[model samples]
Target: MSGRIPHVIRRVGAVVGRLSVYVLIWAGLALLMATAVIRFYWGEITVGQMLLNLVSVETDGGGGPIVWIGVLAIGVLPLLLTVGIAALWQHVRRRERRRRGHDVRPRRSQWVKRTVATALVGAVVVGGTTAFATTVGIGDYIAAGNSKYDLGDYYVEPSVTGAEHRRNLVLIYLESGEATLADDQLFEKDAFAPLKEVTEAADGWQSVADLQQTQGGGWTMAGLTSTQCGVPLKGVGSAAGNGALHELGGEDSYLGGVTCLGDVLDEHGYRSVFLGGANASFAAKDVFLGSHGYSEVKDLSDWRAAGEPEQSFRDDWGLSDGRLMAHAKDEVDELHAEAERTGQPFNLTVLTLDTHEPVHVYDYCTVDTQNVVTSVFFCSMTQVAGFVDHMQEKGYLDDTAVVIVGDHLKHMSAGDAFHEQLDHHDNRTVFNRIWVPGEDGNSTLRPRVDQLNMYPTILEAAGMTLQDRAAGLGVSAFAPDVPAGSAQAMAPEAYADLLGSRSARFYAEAWAGGDAAR
Candidate 1:
């Protein structure tokens, strides 16, 4: 029976020894496969990327399945090694006893053998740890983990120049108003020449769009979202699913929204006005604006009341930019005059349709409809030039800050000019033009602005105190400069959260305010 027991133990020992070897090889191969996957996806994955990926700071307290798997693997390695080695040693001892019979006395050198075994195990462990650390840049990698940026620390300050009283803001968004388009010719310089002359001839302000997240193809909604949310558009699909629309609508209470901006304006005693191009019905313009505290809205149908037939039926999609501009000028004048009479300020938001699609104005244009749409863009520029010039003549320029920005990039059907101007993705470059009555000489600010920062920049210029939460992806042009790569501080998920949350809050508050008034 004793001999049989010894034989059984020996067999178990051999099996365990062989299993250990197989397990070790399996572990090594698994690690290699994982490394290969990382390399392929990242294009340049080093061991450091792997280690960094492991040290996630789980703020949500749910370590998740992946974390649990890692923890279990870490816990099992030592235990498996210890049990395998012990089984092997016991099997070898038993085999020797069975061979010599009568349990032959062990040698005094057993202590020495034990010491050597311990030393060897220690060496393997230390060597493995050192190798892992060195391959992954563990030290520097660990240091980088210390500087995590939270999405809650940003803010925007509202302070308009010379207007001690908080005033309602009117932001007019024109589509595809490239700097070149404002020029007399369809070529690049000609397109932008008028804007250049207007900005250059201004008293103290400088003009620069400082387009951000625009090295890629330009999309119109993407630009509008960036300006409205004070963050880049993220992605078109992302915008569709996320709170870019919801936040502007104020569906969530905490995330800031266009309503939040309106609320801020409301607190300063201003009403929000949203005027869409004649095609306000085409896009969900009325629904969106009405929810965002723009109680008064006038679109294409409204132009019909003024007996403007050409303006009323300009486009199947929307009104002509020329007519929209004309209406806006009249409305703004009325509002400004009313504010003057009542000791209050006004806020207005406008979306222009002149540059809508079908790149209409061709040198040898055959399509009449297309020509009107395209001509309206040029006319819109001329109109904007005249509008600013008119405001200057009326002396109201000193009291207002006029900002001309493109709502979205136009989707050209088939244009070589567009292909030449943008990348393969056809991203419309967001063109921003700002004229603050008196600060026209601030050249230091031209190169330092971004679309995401426009909200805070305007707010700061308008004299409102911005809370840290409002800082968002935008920085005040009046604020200090952040280093180039600092914008990428948050991971993609965190950034999406940052944009989504704020948008949700803005929309929720705006909707709530409108609801309360009703």
Candidate 2:
């Protein structure tokens, strides 16, 4: 009985050791596979961007059934593959042992040793591959410095004296919108035809084919900050002891010392309100907007409080584009009336949400397309065009400068299927259209512009001039005085240096420090 007990104990230990090995193998393989998938989808995933987003409340909450399904598929496939390979390897090893007349029973000591060796090898492989991939993808940006550019002192301040008039500003940030939306070559059907027609026919509208993203310009919050402040949003080196500006709170001042378009408008006595179909709290948008001088930041909670039907909150994101557009029209009337009464120019910024991830199409989406995402894309564009038409019909276009731009390039998750249709989806461009009250088609054409250029371009479109027609490493692409091959033409390496510089870090930290002090 004692001899049988020893054998049973050894068998149980061996089984346990093998099981532990299986878990380690699965984890290691999953890490490698996950990195590959993320790289494929996002091109380059940065540590700072990941940390910033992970800390945000919105990161965990959003996305619907389709998103979860895709996530599960991505997550489960590697695990199953690892298990299958392990099983096959085990079977082959057993067969060999039996053919050689060796002991078929697993030895506890051998199993432990084999498992440790396999786990160690896997760890090394995973670590090496991850390091290499990150280096290739985002290392340049992370190691960037601004020594060559001397952009540390570069700052943009709006000069009301240089302006012909303070035109009312209607800035529409289309969520994950891109030029590819209108590309008939990219999609089986064009999703942005209505928008294209509107921009083509409208005078004073400048449409740019190439609007490239900078280091921090790929994500939504970073895109918004870059376009608005002419600077990239960066995280602090450490958030260990900061009370007010801790990891979660520090995002508010990511562009702290940098002056934004909203600040300029506010200083010039312009009333600014930001309306969005999603939670303004998601990226601390409300805080960012408020700190930058927006008076009212209306978001999901506001819509619900104002008696928006509970059914309308169907999307993972708050209101649908159609519903938001409808609500925006009413808000436009109120703002316009208030502007008329107070004689203050108003800045109405609307951020659409229907085109957000999982590509939820509202019940009102009538566009016919083979892909549900395409249908949603078309429907969102249609809604935007309709709003523009509404503004024109209501006489808001006469004095208002409508600046329509994608907050960022279309998120890769939103275009997984769409990418399969396009010949080359790399370096995808975001859409940009600047409509002044009375001007004809594309007076000036540039080959390409960076996201930072949009900051000064918006002011230029509003008939406002900067002190030097440049702001925060950005020269207005529309400004005649802007020298050719300015920052807009900077090489990717130079731009990365600028993003990774101490000056950029200082600016970010200053913002965080100020927030912490407060």
Candidate 3:
């Protein structure tokens, strides 16, 4: 009976045992990982955003050690778990045979186990499929294809009009900058207070009251594109061929079809530049920036080449915020001097990294708050405040318009900080403060707006006038007019549906730079 059982296991039982178990474990894990990824990338990461990241990973390395390690664990741990599960099954069966005092382990029982395991595997796979489809909003993705409003219908060719004298631009992207962090009633303390104190309205600053991170606008690339290009960033639609993704991924351009902030600024003779502590290639940001119109792009490699010490780095993500801000001050000094000498305006865009999650505590920060994350946020704001103060001291603010904004709202992953109190909070928003030269304390922005409006707002703040005070899907918050049929003019539900839809043909042209009509 034992010999017969070995034969049965080798050919028949083995098929269901190892193969089915492996499938079940992997399928289960994949579901969990998908949920985790969504949480890590703000409240949700749409399918288009996932496709963009897939392209980004293939083109460049898959970002830092933390991201890569997570990927590796997903692939590797399943194999080990499957093997262990198989071993346990064999041991239990053998023990039962010994207890029976004969080679009488029934083949019928073995068949039953195989049948059960196979059924379980199938169930898991089907369940995972359903869950994944729901998580990514497959229904909405399909429905969007037929939606009446298309991105093309609303996209305005971004342009700066009527500014005889262009002021310099100092755009700062705060990492995971949520206005909720300012709610002292909820969290331990206000992390944004230092920066807020420096940018007070009496001190010649103005702010949009409820700056939102729009649907499909949570990730860095999406945020950057929305705020700069005045449109929500999306990947190729499912209706497009696989070759379409390949076409979009190439060095040609990111969103080449539309004229973006960089494009308009370049046309208007503003010297555009970007500075960040991470690898710009992580999301093909270099391609996006270069193709759009930025003259200079600075990332980790450039800093390394410039001889930054290895000790200054963390998580293999490059320099700490402290060091990056120091370099930023110097950069502003040089740019300010150059502008003074050449009479050309400049845009020095800066992105902070200290508050990015999987938070790290720098030596400069003292963790006084209950949550280390909040303390780090406070420290980061202090750094930004110092930079703002330096610009003030140098009299650079006299002509430069400073816009400090969150790239996106804070993500709420399982391991992330601040989600406990924030998880149920209905009114989460991004933080922002704007400083325009010679503005009175009385000037105010529209009560509610999204990142899209920042494009024209920034342009207008730098003394450029828009024809309708509008561009892309957004109208300037600094201006009161919401053009008929503009996103701002649409009903909330209707506007959301527009964002959720694929807009396949429109994005195709937009990605290829073929739709220049708007």
Candidate 4:
């Protein structure tokens, strides 16, 4: 009886060990498979990028049932494959033992040990490949002192000549809006016809044919920061520390070292206000804007405080773009009145949210379209155009420059149903239209322009000339020295390397120290 008990204990231990190994193998393989899925969906899958954007994913309320279904598929496929392979291997061994007339029970412990070894080896292989790929992908960016461009050479300082008359600026950032929306051939119907009409009919409005996205330029905060500051927004430390700028200790002064467009406007005695249809705290937008001299920052919370009903007009993000624009019209009137009283130029920057992911269409502002995304675009464009027309009707257009720009290219999944109705949809460009006060209705279509150039371009549109027609690594598209498709524009890859360099870290640390002092 004692000998039988010892044998039973050993058998139980072997089974437990084998099951642990199987679980580990499946987990490792599933993680690798998930990495591949993420990479396919979003071009990059770095830990830093994931951590920095995790908050936005949680707060934005963008993903729908389709996203969760995809996630489930990614998780289950690897598990099913692992289980199927293991079962087949076990069945073959069992059949061979039965044919040989050998008691498979006698060798059960040995077979369990072998299976555990094989599972461990499989896990190691999968994990090793994933690690190697991640290291190779981001190695150049993380290498110390490897910056190819000097920050000083690309810094843009607006030299406002006394002869140049400053104009009021109204910059509107459309979330995930793209030029493809206006391309009739790309969609079943034109998604941005209203916006296209506004651009085509208005003077000094040019549609940039090519607007390449740089590293950190694909996301909203990154896109906005790059366009405003002429630099990519990079994470400061480990994954755990990449939340809002306010949470980053001394690093709270967003782009403290860089001279942003808002800073220049502040220097010229312009009162700037940033109004967004999302929480400003989500991406530290308030911190960035306040640090950079935006006089007032208004967001969803402000809307609620101002007696706007939250239930009917607000979605997961905030108030609909329809409501935002409506509120903006009133705010613009008040700001303009104050400007008239004080004789100070005011910069009103409005960020629309209707076109954000999950593509929520407000019932009150619905367009006649089956596709939710298309409807969102139609409604947003109509509202924007109406706002512009209102400004024009009120004589605001005579001394004001209105610039409508897509913050980043659209980030729709490849598996989206909307992709079925497109032609040559590989290289999508962001939408950009600049309407200055006095120029003739001539379109200056540039072949390719990076987001960084927008920093100088916005200033130029506001009637401010750059000291050397360049700011940071971005040469203005309108600069005389920057000819069409010039090499003066830094490549996106090169800019990414700069962001990862030790010199960039040094600059960031210095900025943090300055913020701490203040």
Candidate 5:
């Protein structure tokens, strides 16, 4: 009866073990399939590409079929070996159990019992650790918490204030113009010499932090969008989509997602221009530009007759920043005359192209990929300097409240590490600075300002009335009492609300047939 009981117990254990195996296998398969489907459809992963990435770690080099087969083999090998080892160990333990009493053990090392006891203790410790981990909701909770910031904390409600100097706004969104000092070593680096010289000489050229685009990357469209829209590129939440730009002439879509500086300027009867080096058609540019109230747009097709070469198109983009500025200078001159005739200030925009990615050509510096990307950043600064010089020569510098800033910091390139053993605090944020012409000496503003606040600053500088609370998000250098760190710029959600409210108002007005085009 004792032997029969042992056999019955062994049989029951085998059945339970097999059932657990099947259950685990099914659960794993279901989880894999669900993840695959999500990645395929909503995440926009193609069938072929999905399989390829699964089988091959990187598709950069060749070996398509073989690479995939190797991937499968490597993934499965460890599991198979583990299973085999477990089965063998179980078989040995079962023999020992059958041969001896239920409490029987195999011959082992001197410390084997102690080791097993320690492992059991370790398992208890691991179980507690796992419970704590699950309770904490570790990584995702931390990230989401960090991204959250309150507007009330930063923007205290205050009264509206008036300003002087209502000049025509000409915001030249010079592509990638980071206000950095020039370096002597690199070529193609002289672009920003004009800005450097001017800022150095002028006592009023104040600098603030760079505009941080949401993703820390360049889409050109995103940069322009953030600049004009005065919000981070992402999280436009619940905004209207005007329509497709494929059929519309010029800009086809209504840029409803962002609160635009254009609408504000347009409210003041300033005709805004959206000009750039990228094609007018690229990446919803036409719709974003048009819907955001750019009265005139000059992209690649517009520059065809400017005697720019077919190979100069090999500038691998639209027009050079230098060329774009020259064209913009001409456009500004025309708009100035027209504004004089109509008694309306012209809002000119020249989105420059030269200092963008590949940072190949600048007036002063160039960098090899082997060096740090900040080496190339120096090139962008030089280009800005040169552009500023040109603007000054053409009288675009005087009395015109100019705002030049980087769309975002340069993303560090691969294999190019900043290996200096500097103090940890010294290497914190990589955002660039904002340069407000003639507003430098104001002590009321904080030492650090962010990118999104730039829109209000421009509006305030150009003589628009802003609430003291709204102005808390920004400071007018022209204002007598500027509080240090009084305004800390918009966080992502507040920024979203700011943009959405303005954009919705624009759409609502446009729908009602009042100031829609404006």
Candidate 6:
């Protein structure tokens, strides 16, 4: 029995050794595919946000799954093929050795050759991937984007004024809401026309003429962080040393040390709530909101619990925008009534999920345009328009400051719908409309102001004045003039450099706390 045990152990070790080559291949291919797919969908994403999404985020049940499917195909298919070929070769070698009446064992030279080949494959994969990452600016995505200045020096503790005369805020984030798509000459149809007509400047809505999406601000989390926190979303410094992430995806309160718009409102005795069609758990939206100040969160599960029809609860990303808008209207009415009864102000933040690519076409949307995405964008607008019309009718606009803006620019990935017109388009800007009561409807905003500026702009629109019209890294577009060297006033190149920095001390304090042991 002891002799048999040794033989069994030897056999098992041999099998593991043989399988290691295929395992290595599979791992390398999987990593390559994952990086490629992530970059394709979200260009210039931070390593922190990328890792967080990998470990914590939920998929848009529709197009989001397709990306993973493609990655799996690359990872698994090549491994299967390699294993099958290796097995066949081993069988042929065994047959030949038997025919010659000799040992079937592979020669030392053959083993050496196999080891060399496997090592070469690993090198090529790792080397090629590194080259690709470098080409795409590894520093930009990694934690070394800027090394010039400490972000802590520039960060201002967020403050709010005029709490006594607070106005309800309706902040809507439109998916892929790029103003570039509005040009009829560039594209076949103006996708933003419906939204434009609904929130026309002539109708008391002020639109930002040049609402730029900041550099390294491609994904939803980045946009949300910038707009709410007035700071760009960068990852914590190396956590595991093995390149594994441990911060953003974990239970550690998201940027617990940082103060945000929600926190300010909460401190001033405002009831804050967030509503979205997708899962609140995605990208730690709940964690961020809860940590900051939101008291109520309405997401996919909430809508489902309320008995939305299965069809209306879109498999791609929970409820459709049409359905989400309907619920938002109801939520506004309920909140407005409660506010009037209690005399406490409220904030309703809504995020739309349609127009997210592999754009899911629901029953309510019509496909009149040649590009399906265009039609989808137009349909999403109709839903937003409906909510705007509702606010106007209920006279909610009288006391509510409505801000409609896109989360980020449209993705022009390889498989996305509108690359023909969207790709390499020099003119790309996020569309934004701000409607503040008792303000000039035709107010001209600071040109070239990016999404970061929206943080303070929203505060001011709600009648909360910032001492310097600045918070975090942004200046208010509503401010008469931005500080000369502030983020909003800096040149585009310099501003990108400023936000792209590692900011280890600053982020460490922001993520953990100023006094918490690192």
Instruction: Give, for candidate 2, the lowest lDDT window spanning 10 residues.
Output: 235-244
Total backbone collisions for each predicted model: 56, 4, 1, 1, 32, 3
The list of candidate 1 runs beyond 4 A from truth reads 1-168, 180-189, 213-222, 231-260, 310-312, 360-376, 410-417, 424-429, 446-449, 467-470, 482-518
Tens digits of per-residue lDDT for model 4, 156-199: 44455541678889999988877777766665567777777767
Supply the TM-score for candidate 5: 0.55
lDDT of 2: 0.70
Candidate 3 off by > 4 Å:
1-43, 58-63, 83-111, 238-244, 247-250, 516-518
**TM-scores for every predicted model:** 0.55, 0.78, 0.89, 0.76, 0.55, 0.87
Give residue 395's error in model 1 in angstroms. Answer: 1.2
TM-score of 6: 0.87
Clash count, candidate 4: 1
lDDT of 1 by residue, 435-503 (tens): 665564655553534466666656655455565323445655555455343343445565444443323
In model 2, state the lDDT of residue 350: 95
Clashes by residue pair, model 2: 145-497, 203-439, 204-439, 204-440
Local error of candidate 4 at residue 67 (angstroms): 13
Maximum-TM-score candidate:
3
In terms of lDDT, model 4 sits at 0.68
Maximum-lDDT candidate: 3
lDDT for residue 273 in candidate 6, whole number 0-100: 92
lDDT of 5 by residue, 1-518 (tens): 98999999999998897556544433343334333333222222222222212322322112123334444443454346436645765697687677666754456742585487456444544553443333322333234334444322343222336534567776656454433323334323443454556665245665543233433223344455445543434221112243312222333444453346676676667788866765665444566666666787777767776777654442455565555666766777787678768877767766655544444444333454454344545544455455566656766555465666555433222212232311222322223323444555544443344454555666765656776524323444334454544533445555544432323333333323233324
Scored against the true structure, residue 486 in model 6 reaches a CA lDDT of 70
User: What is residue 303's positional error in candidate 5, in angstroms?
Assistant: 1.8
